[model samples]
Target chain A: MTADLHTLTGAYALDALSPEEAREFARHLTECDVCTHEVAELRETAARLALAVAEVPPAALRARVMAAIPEVRQLPPPGRVADVVPLRGRAWRQRLPYLALAACLVGAAVAGGVAVNAEHDVDRQRTQAEQQASDLASLMAAPDAAYHTTAVHGGGNATVVSSVSQARTAFVYRDLPKLAGSHVYELWYSRKGSMVPAGLVDSGRPSGTAVLAGAASGADGVGLTVEPHGGSKQPTTSPLMLVSIAG
Target chain B: MRAAAREEQPGAPRPGALETLLDRVSRGDRDAFESVYTAVAGSVLGLVRRVLRDPAQSEEVTQEVLIEVWRSAARFDPGQGSAMAWIMMLAHRRAVDRVRSAQASADREHKAAVRDHSPAFDEVSEQVERRLEREQVRRCLGQLTELQRESVTLAYYRGFTYRETADLLGAALGTVKTRLRDGLIRLRDCLGVSV
Candidate 1:
């Protein structure tokens, strides 16, 4: 009689719900314990996201936005309003950004921390994501672990099958997406030979050949990670892929 | 600036200044544009900075948003909503565009690489008391449930789409929307913003 947790989780956090469904469930929220707890988790998540954004424009931006409005055509001037009653509240105060901007910024970053999931298919997005997390975590946990890369879908559409070469002791990605504009896939061999970084890969998918120092051939397979428009000389974060030459 | 900490504040939400000036600017009312510029440029700028992480890009988007405010001012219908919401919408859209343009990684990844990003929300929160709109937002957020408050703030300030919020929190999307709506309603009540 009861919907499962995934259904509730997906429905609440992802809002994959239809309009009617959202309204129907919303009515139930007042009585549903399942709904209340889940909603809280989602809200906290939301706050962190806002924190991710770092920019805060000065008041001057608003002045520019307002100065551009044409009251004569849109409505009478403020003094000769047709409908509005020229109401500006007393609580209203204007000065400059203070400590609140800083606190909200923290809240936003944590909320926005989850950027984008590489996959969109419901099944893959839900289950594969969990498995990938575990796999990455296990690899990262290894004391002797070297550099790693998380599997990335190439070209935004193509599937980069991340498979292991059990015999050769490395991982290989097939169907890598084509590079775009100034962006290219960079491969990093681990630093200290323990998952630091190796190097970069050219547009080697679909046709061209690409290489990663293959130095991790004995340790953990070289990992492929995304950097800036141009690849970074050193690894900035963990790789998207982690394959043992024999993995 | 805080000298008037005890004095009553003025003109927090002025009505109808934007559209009139925008229309004039569209019709070559250079002086009107400047006046409108003087009125809400600060709001637009603050909103833009809150959304876009890159300053150069923020300035660039701000320029485009302002230009669009002028160029598209004719399409604005004051009857439907206040001119303020319309401006916020434009600024919001531009900021969203900038966020999307960045390569999205998992939320946890950024948590560790947090050092790479610019000012944190905590820092912004600290400076907010000095801001007019931020103060309004704080009062409004206070009305929401802890969950609802967080949900709405994340959506607007962090520039997250609903789905991202779900994944990060491991919660349902429907919950995210409900909380957002709840929080927004509370905020609207507090700030008296129509939308």
Candidate 2:
């Protein structure tokens, strides 16, 4: 029943078309019930993509894009030609003596194209810039982030914060010797008689464990606890340290 | 509402770069246009950053893009495209013009590195333009057939027409069209768009 719905979906997402082609399809879109319905779905996909890279272009470039928009938007509309819009049926024919009507039409067409094109151009650049910035941001947060953070822990110990989320939190901890035999180190975050088990971290010498990230903006401090091997959901022991979060 | 917003939006061309700012400057408002200039300079500067290796040259290009933007602020048309597109096109055209005018060395180098150039290192700010903001394009791009995806990317983002795309991919002309059309269709479907 669905005749290659996927391909049409892709086409609509990118707006990759000659103007004429776009117009033809636009007409079909109005008439076809399936297409109208499908458009809504595909648009969501497009929006997600558009938002993928919301990185702000450099400050200076924002002005450039804005500045260029007027002129770049000078593109002629979908199918407008160099025909003048009549000012009035009576005022039009009478004033046609100086060829002003034709001249205005030509001027308007050229001006219009330039106007539209500028707008399109700046829009394109800004979008590309933002998209690129977002890409870079994600890359920085990825496991293979180019940024290296040697988070300084208590006792002058430093551990590499390998991963960070957009919320600006990183898994942080430092060197601890491997436990011998059946013993294992557990990780827990305690706050107000309630300890949230972040995870069961290894006792691999110099291993890093995820912490309860930085601190609550106005909170007093954070505490970490250790428990028996494989760790329980609740804290069973006192914290190794009560790190103070800066206000 | 549109008129009020339009007053804040700059896009006409006048005499000097300062001339464009004159409208804002007339009411003892130099600071306002300066704010505008500073806010939207990223695309212009970024273009210079990518195209010109020499810091001085890049600065010069950036200046030119900005100055031109100021000059042409009066003619902006809000109906056709958003303000962002207008500025980017100015920057892009200036950049491309510079690339073309620089003879061949820089052009050859950039073209060589286009694919290798990762769209990274641009996270300096938080107000990105909308057109380039689509992350789904890249992610969803994975869902497409290799040929279809490449066909669209190379043609649109990479600046190739069907003919050029055909030559580069070593496919037939018709194949390129079908790839573009069908790929777009699939993308639209995935995106759920009408236009």
Candidate 3:
């Protein structure tokens, strides 16, 4: 499954995937450096194909485009204050919008056709969240916002919503099987083929939500492993949930 | 693979000119925005029109794409790709999105006859101002296997999803995906696109 996703770079760059599949591949891109590079080069190549067929528009179209420009507001660059959000705040209620988006996505796994309403739900949440938590709001509102869900080896599904433009990914664990003793679920981002510790979740919680530590852009994949309570410098056990986010 | 040092083609915007203009546009310079519009409008309209087929809708989408370039100029990251690539990606995505949405509306109306049929590929437009680019692209496309060529032209030029492309080509889904990737990789090298 993961290998198949990697080959999608060409189709993805050409906008040949269905919208849902495109979103899934885009989410994969956040962790896949190879895919990211391949997609960029492929998009450039496809754009050349666009140039090959280039035609001059009716002369009057230029006036219309220029007239419409001043009315639109330019977006602030990424990393502007408007784009930054805490990795994970203790105030979980501020994350309701993300959860709502996640819930709608959970529905998508069961019924793919229901994504249209999910999109509308996300839009509504985006508007509501904008006033409350600008960080989560901007992420949920990102034009490239995408979600990926995978089964944990032990139990339940791990759902992540990522915005490459924002360089952040938010994760939620649903019905994850609780571990025994002092063991905890530790998150690791496979950056450039090496595991970097991201965050940890308590084993007692059946469900939890948090944003991954560090920037997600260009990471190769995301992994979860059972580790000691405070977490290990590196994964001490095989990953129970290894998501090959490779492009 | 030094794309910057490639022989300058006539009628193409000079290397980095669009980037400089986009930088100024990002700073809210109206004159720079005008230059950016002039630099990109032809290709944007041409590409959108190819995907949409309706002249009026194509013009509207072209206007929307340029305005989008203005609205999102700050988001343009030159390190990832060239300014032309960035602008054309926005235009292509907008064009594809418009077609998909229109298709959805037609589907909702249960208009069976409105289903998308494969259009003829490589319909050369005589109005292309960049003959040099057209020739280069034509030459590179000519080098691909027939399957690879069909896979790419069906998806990129005709706005078909990969499954639809596979259906059109009567090939397996995996085969289409590989052909698209391999075909573009070959094209990228042939075009001297530096990653």
Candidate 4:
């Protein structure tokens, strides 16, 4: 029997076509705007039909679904390449000078004793930053990574990428207002009800990643708060941003 | 039909509201997900229950569909359709998958029984419930001829392909396809769904 692709529009919209027929219709659809519009309308009708059957879900389902959200991971926003690449490139550019200065300090260690310790600190931090960048890259690529993007209280936005299975997380901040004085952005992990200190975040750059302690398995959510230069044992103020770790 | 009785009072939540919630959900907003769940879980579960005919399995599929919505919210395009439609489409797909997989397992257990019981009785009750639930949809569905309604319902609610639906109804494959297409066109028009 000769099959008219147009006749398959309803079956295609309902996803009732056989695999081969479905593929054939998909190919046909690209060349057939009329069929495409027809299919869209059919789908809308089907959706409305589906809506007619709305019965109240079990009461327990609400809590179950809500609890599951934190555990599920979200897809990264579009233009992920654009978001990640430039920041890494800019960081590399900024780090090159510091690396050069560190080398110069090593060379002039005999001239100034103080330069050696400062150079060591810089090297340590640079190594840490590199590790954090690598972690951020891996988290971004992880198929199971759950992401949450939230606006900071004062200004800017933060994207938190976490994997409960990996027990790791990375926070990316953009356009955060530079804090003056001894204040710093500190991270916290809230589990059940209590909050635990995670780490300090630097707000000096236009964009940067903050690597928090890898204990996502134990945490239900992540929060950021402004604290003294060194993080407080407990959050001394309200969170600047609170992101639920569930997807 | 129960659905026909309720047609005078359209009860579906505004599609625009769902669209806005979906946009927020795309931004990784957990609160929006909760709100969206509250808005659509019943409908999603109801659809799945109709297709699967097993409350336990339907619940599992519903959870999976909702989690998928959370994970793939970024892919939702408001330009294409309303969020409710996008969500319902997901529900239908997942439910169909469950139905097909269950059929596959039943075939493995008893291949002959699978053919003998193409569309189970429980499935029919679920379909009746579905029809009774939405008045406008029922009214629209009622517009289709008997052959058209059977072909469409077997293929859609029972998760049968056109060929399977044809086999179940003892009709030609081409005939089933034509009936489904015609039925859907009538339903779309009756429901006043715009292309």
**Candidate numbers, best TM-score first, in rank order:** 3, 4, 1, 2
Docking verdict class for candidate 4: incorrect
Worst 10 residues of 2 chain A by lDDT: A106-115
Clashing pairs in 3: A6-A247, A31-A219
Candidate 1 local lDDT, A64-173, one digit each (tens): 44454443333233443232222221111111022123222322222112233445545654574354334433332121222222235343211111122211112223
Error of 1 at B64 (Å): 0.8
Query: Number of the top candidate by DockQ?
Result: 3
List the lowest-lDDT window of 10 residues for candidate 1 chain A: A89-98
Which residue pairs of candidate 4 clash? A70-A246, B3-B135
| Model 4: residue B52 alpha-carbon error in angstroms | 0.8
Minimal lDDT window, size 10, model 4 chain A: A107-116
What TM-score fits each model?
0.39, 0.35, 0.55, 0.53
Tens-digit per-residue lDDT, A126-174, candidate 3: 5643432334434443434444455677886665555667787656566
Best by TM-score: 3
TM-score of decoy 1: 0.39
lDDT score at residue B50, model 1, on the 0-100 scale: 60
Runs with alpha carbons beyond 4 Å of true place in candidate 2: A1-247, B1-40, B43-62, B100-102, B105-107, B110-134, B155-162, B174-195
Residue A64 lDDT in model 3? Answer: 67
For candidate 2, lDDT tens digit of each residue in B1-195? 112232323332211122223333233233334434533454445444454434445545766766665565545443323334445545544544454454643554545434232233222233233333244456567778999888876644333445667789999866776787666667766654432
Residue B11 lDDT in candidate 1: 20
